[model samples]
Target chain A: MSDTSANRRQRVQSAETGMSVLKALARLGGDASLTAIAAEVDENAAKVHRYLLSLVQEGMVAQNAATQHYHLGPESVRIGLAALRQCDPVRMGEMALVRLRESLQVTCFIAVMGNRGPTVLRIEEPSLPVTVNMRAGSVLPWLWSASGQAFLAFSDDADIRVQAQAEFDAGNEAQRSMLAGPDPVARLCRQVKEQGCAIVIDTLLRGISAVAAPIFDARGRVVAVLTALGASNGFDARPGGKVCPQVMREAATISHAMGFGPG
Target chain B: MSDTSANRRQRVQSAETGMSVLKALARLGGDASLTAIAAEVDENAAKVHRYLLSLVQEGMVAQNAATQHYHLGPESVRIGLAALRQCDPVRMGEMALVRLRESLQVTCFIAVMGNRGPTVLRIEEPSLPVTVNMRAGSVLPWLWSASGQAFLAFSDDADIRVQAQAEFDAGNEAQRSMLAGPDPVARLCRQVKEQGCAIVIDTLLRGISAVAAPIFDARGRVVAVLTALGASNGFDARPGGKVCPQVMREAATISHAMGFGPG
Candidate 1:
């Protein structure tokens, strides 16, 4: 029994080492040498080299003869894009947000309810001085701002909300109470249903006003939220700023295209 | 010697099998069970299971407990996006094309000289009834389309042009002779140098016209081309429809942003 337990521990450690190598390569932006990878993972070069060789043999890693550097092979991108496409909510919302950023000349984003809170899956910014620089994979908590509210309003999973509330409560009791008041999710849901949009003022970033709407799938399930953000000053200057209605309409258009019914 | 050669052959076969499994998972949109992956790759489930265990241990694959299926892990996207950022020329050109499509409500594309010919890297279309549906990754031979001509005109690589000519010559003598006249690349370079743009009408896609300009890097090398494509009827109807100066201006704007010299 002692021997079996020791073997299992060794196996687990080996698995962790393999995972560390993949993560180190990933964090290096898919391009790294064995030495660099070893340094990153704080492992011996010989050990990392063996792992890399195995990955290369598996076609997940390819070494360029000219550069003598390892890169994530074409198969990596192929799989990554495929996985992204499977998340129909994020994919469709990103496409629509791309169009919206073009039309409105503002920063657009798609956020989803993640384990932590709202995770920004996509961001499109116009060539403007005041443009936001947020990109994909950025996570923010629920009490931070509008994106959080938009996500909370549309998410149908009660357990997820409970989890999010517990996290929020642990972090900031005042903000959690404010967020929990009058059943915020229920009220926001009714507003989203009635107005087909959510207007958030100074909720997330200071002086950054935004308009957002829930993105639904073919099953009328809210999968994501689309938001356009910019400086609060002059936000309502141009017909309530081109982004608000435009974002709402674009979200609706995307939702419709995804086979969702009208609000 | 025979035993050594057989061992090497087996290794290659295993690598190929691994690649096939990866491709199958990508085609399945990044989620697959061992059985599904085995069926897709025409392999035994046991063989595929071992490969999957390796992948999972590496954190390249994550299993959904509810579905008991595997999908691409977040690490994949991190690497892919990093690879994308390093290829900044493609991203810069794509952003310009996205802007042009939004502003003009026309079809815009970015094409680069690939091994075969001109490959479409990105395509942005206006939300219109007659929008073009040209997919990304579609390759077309050089000397057959406006994008090809644009790329040829700006390319400094002599071998690429020679190879492109050889490909053109392999088809028909008459077509080769037509393409051979006046060194299209030289003329295009001169025209782009003087006017900062290139316009081609019915040269590639029938009933479609295009105006393109070279985008230069900070080092002043032409890294990519920005193009605006539209219906020939509409193009011609709008004042020298085949020669829209505004399209050229937009391309120049993108080039300037990309650190090109004055148009």
Candidate 2:
């Protein structure tokens, strides 16, 4: 690359590193010390401290005076609120999730393809309010989750495969041979695309299972993945299963509401 | 200020200026151009342009490929999601807003004192879903809206008075003599505190009225302000009106949920 372009690239890379510190704090449950944040991002503590100071000054993060731990600031909240409003997929999918949860007696969540992974955007629980880890803004990995597999299989983006491959490559060495080559993932994708849904049993978390379906927009583009999660013992993963079809129906409803149709 | 302190202050001010560009885009509904952002922040175009480029690179802002208009990025959404999960006032207050809307058959909202103004955090509408302009992330001035007035009156923070005074001084000539002095605002605050609610009629917007109450934490600090709003014709703003008492009751419920009281 040319010198100027290389310089620009370095600037952008540094900027992304700064953003990663913020994301690290978020991933660590929204409040952490500089040491923790640096360890999460695997960056130097002194550098992360400078970045945190700048972010705090910019109001993207705030440190509690008493505890001296940093969390996302009010401005980040406002910016996120704006992002949530601007994204129609999450907003429209919420009503469908609520309806599904009310009728299905299961916990339903919407996960969109965020930069890192399939990030949960909205969630609804049954009357009992089942204890589930999924929530809005949580990013679940693609290697072993219903929402991840659904998006991986059904999304039109060819880049999805590249991302999945990167994540798989980053996975532990022992797990690489479990699913074999790209053939396995491709075969599963074909099956999911044919059945119009994806199901996983105790994939990511023990004693929990999920069924999810791809949600498309007007142009038939996969915009999000909607899932129903519950205890593994009673939860069904069959395409013909009760909770499975409901998630697909909700996905179709949300997709239609998002302007996806016969056109 | 000493030379070192002066330099530190300038650096922090510059960082804040960069953040202002992001806030400006959020204020203008989360998509604007470099010129628009600079104009909104009242900074030079070159400086704001640099800020936008940096912000976009940081993933705090994103520019449309076609329009080149800047919008909040996914990272900002993630941070904001973290903020929403962390802030109990907005989250816990949501249940009260929903209950109030359902039981009272009106549109209810929660507004917290944001950096700029009284920012709406959540809104719940009745079964019919009332057509109201207010939404999450909207900032309402303290000098006008019911939620704003509630915060001004019931909040224990002395800075609240300073903020109100600053806004009043910046107001146009007509509004200056309208509230007369701090005594009038003080008296209104006293009445609101005494009644545990605040009401406004045909003040901020035409044909609209509202009633609001403060949500306090365990320390008795005002955390949020809850308000019910509708058309002036059918909407009652009377102290003993149907919606007024219910709002106060709901506010009390939310305050309790927020961990208010010795019990």
Candidate 3:
């Protein structure tokens, strides 16, 4: 690279390093000493201290005088809540998940297409011994599960597709083949449109199956995907997954309630 | 100031400028061009552009190809969410508000003591026509509200008291008097503890009456204040204000659920 290019690259690297330091402190539950943050991010302690002090001055991080350790300040929470306020998907999907879990006695989840891939935004697990135990904020590949397929099917945005493809390719070789195709997403979209749902039988986890449907916002834009997760063993044996159709209908009802429509 | 002090002051000014730029972008809902950011923050366009470029490289801001305007990047949301996840007050208080709203048939809120004053962490409005309409993130004075009184009553920590008092004194002269005392907070705490709740009549909004009880965490630390809000005109004149007893009971239940005890 040219000298100017190298300088630009170094500047970007330094910026990324600083951002990484902030992320490290955040991931440590918003409290970390300079030495601890440095160890977590594998950076120089003195440099980390400088970055932390700057954050403290900006009111994004607070240092306890007695412990000399940092925690997230109110300003940080304010910023985060601002972003969350913009997310209509979480607002619309939470109540739907609650209702689905109550009626079906199964786990319900809402997953959104993230910059990296598909991420579970919320999960509502039935208070049953046999319920699925997935947590919110968990990331999954675009091709590995039913919720991912449902999200990809309804998501027509080109940027999301490209990013998802790139992330899928960066995974293991075996995972890459599962996600590779000239028009895999388009094909999935067609299937979802035809079936009105995406069903996966043990694609991600053995003996686990899920049926997912897309959720839309007032603008008819796909905002999220709602999925009912259950065991595959007795699914077909019991009423062809008796709850699947009801769950799909409930998902559609929620989408319509949020102002999407087949009406 | 000495020459070294001047240099330090200059650095602080630059840092403040950087933070101001970021805050302006955030207040604008995380999307703005350099020109707009400059106008919003009252900075030079070129200098704002430099700051925007730095933020872009740091992954705190991203420029849209179509609009060329900056938006909050995924990394910024990630950082914010990480900070929110550490806020035990919000997490515990949100659940309590949910239950309190269900039980009381009135608006419920959770406010935390902060440097700026008392900040509402969550609000759950009842599904009634005359219910309170306060937003979740609204900030209020620490000396004039039931939430503030509850915080003062339950919190024995010195640092929180100092921060809350500084914020209370920074208000208008009339408001400042509410916080003035050799031990204003101790008196407030005593009243709240004796009454088992704090009643704020027309202290915040005119014609608004509120009662708040404290929420404590597993370690007996006061984490939040739960309040029931209603219009003052008919609140005491009707059976609706009976919600106060339920509100106090539910608040204690929630505090107990979070591991606080009477002792």
Candidate 4:
């Protein structure tokens, strides 16, 4: 190969090794002795120590003055917050919708807690799309919609409570009966939290069934909700049904992209 | 020299270059084209492209499939969040106290919004200590203490408002008179917010004055308050004074270390 082609094919092995050491620090819970990091990365202590020195110089790893244990430094925190600032939930959730549509063959959408209520932010439809009335920017009811239920269950924001109270007061007799309790809003929320996802069978719309799951941020706050629905006659909305796991899994994947889980 | 000694002395230049590229991408607001990143790092496009490929493989960088722009990837987010999890405000504030004690020759302490109120978590005393009765775990009053006022000015937590109201209702005649007006709590909060830092001249303790500033987290919430105090007779606690700027500067530095600034 020519020099240019050969250079193009060459990978920077030292950089890759450095990144491995950094990842090992993260996997060790962001704090460890030099020996522990060396053992975790399966490298010799002296070599790992050299890389740690370089990392400390770069401000990616810091050493404790008292104990000499190494931990991630301020630059890592700055870069992570920068990455988080770029983590667009709507864009990531849209990718999830496309995947869910293909896997479950059902219409899927992502909703965020907007000023009014849970508003649909993005949507994806199967080849044969379900004829739902909702579209992007459609405000889902706080009590009657699966997306809203997920928010009520997972989020503790005061605005959700206000909206829920308003819906409870204005709910029709049949709707109130469906909620079925002295404190129906609380009861519904408790049920959804216990179930770990929200399910609706012909509740929000006639002949439609849906499943919804919450998406969380690094701080463990619900940032959005992912929902999937189809005709009730063919769609299974139970927690154990096929659509439920797919929706929850997709929601979790988006949450991971949003930096939600363990480091 | 022995081969082993020679190897030990060698620094990984490629790894350092890779880290520089990553930092450059972050400086470019976490998203940019290959040409932009190369120019920012002052490196040749070919060399930067090779580093980008390695970074992409290591999951530290991602390219937009449509636009072909590079951005920080999931691994960077994960590592950043990991670093954030390791960010302990009390531990960092303690170090800040040590520095302030040396340079400013004042007693410094860090307080967090605990269940009761602004509770002192860590304290550092200078060589010539101020004769303060409070120690770590001393919860200061909401309306009287500079630390408490920092939270009042910046935080929107509902609990703080309730605590302020309770303090307002229970204030003694003299204390209530000091906080004069139809809505003294609101007025105090507004004044503190406008000032950008809370100042107390012999308000909390006779002959003791303090300047307190808020320390923010990545989410821009006030995580802790740092205060420096000395005898009011000799101490200059006004905004334009030497003590006020030093306290605010230290708090801002700690906030930056806590990932509270621009990417």
RMSD values, in order shown: 21.1, 21.2, 21.0, 6.0
Tens digits of per-residue lDDT, candidate 4, A223-259, equal 8999999999989888888898888888998887676
lDDT (Cα, tens digit) per residue for candidate 2, span A1-263: 12365446434344456567777888787788888999999988877776777677666786765577887766666666666567577765767777788777788888888998899978888878657776789998776888998999987677888877777778776445545655667877887888889887776778888899988864477889999988888777778978887888888876754445421
lDDT of 3 by residue, A62-170 (tens): 6655577777665565555444445366654566778777876667788877766678888888776354546788887666677877777777777766765665667
RMSD from true fold, candidate 3: 21.0
Candidate number of the best DockQ: 4
Which rank order by lDDT, best down to worst? Answer: 4, 2, 3, 1
Clashing pairs in 2: A218-A260
What CAPRI class is candidate 3?
A: incorrect
List per-prediction Cα lDDT, in the order shown: 0.63, 0.75, 0.67, 0.85
Q: Best lDDT goes to which candidate?
A: 4
lDDT of 2 at B232: 88
- What fraction of the true Cα-Cα contacts (under 8 Å, chains A to B) does candidate 4 also have? 0.55
- Report the C-alpha lDDT of model 1 over A157-196, residue by residue, as the tens digit: 7865675556565765545554555666565556655666
TM-score of each: 0.37, 0.40, 0.40, 0.76
Looking at chain B only, the TM-scores across the models are 0.55, 0.62, 0.55, 0.86
Candidate 3 accuracy as lDDT: 0.67
lDDT against true structure, model 4: 0.85
Lowest lDDT 10-residue stretch of candidate 4 chain B = B1-10
The most accurate candidate by TM-score is 4
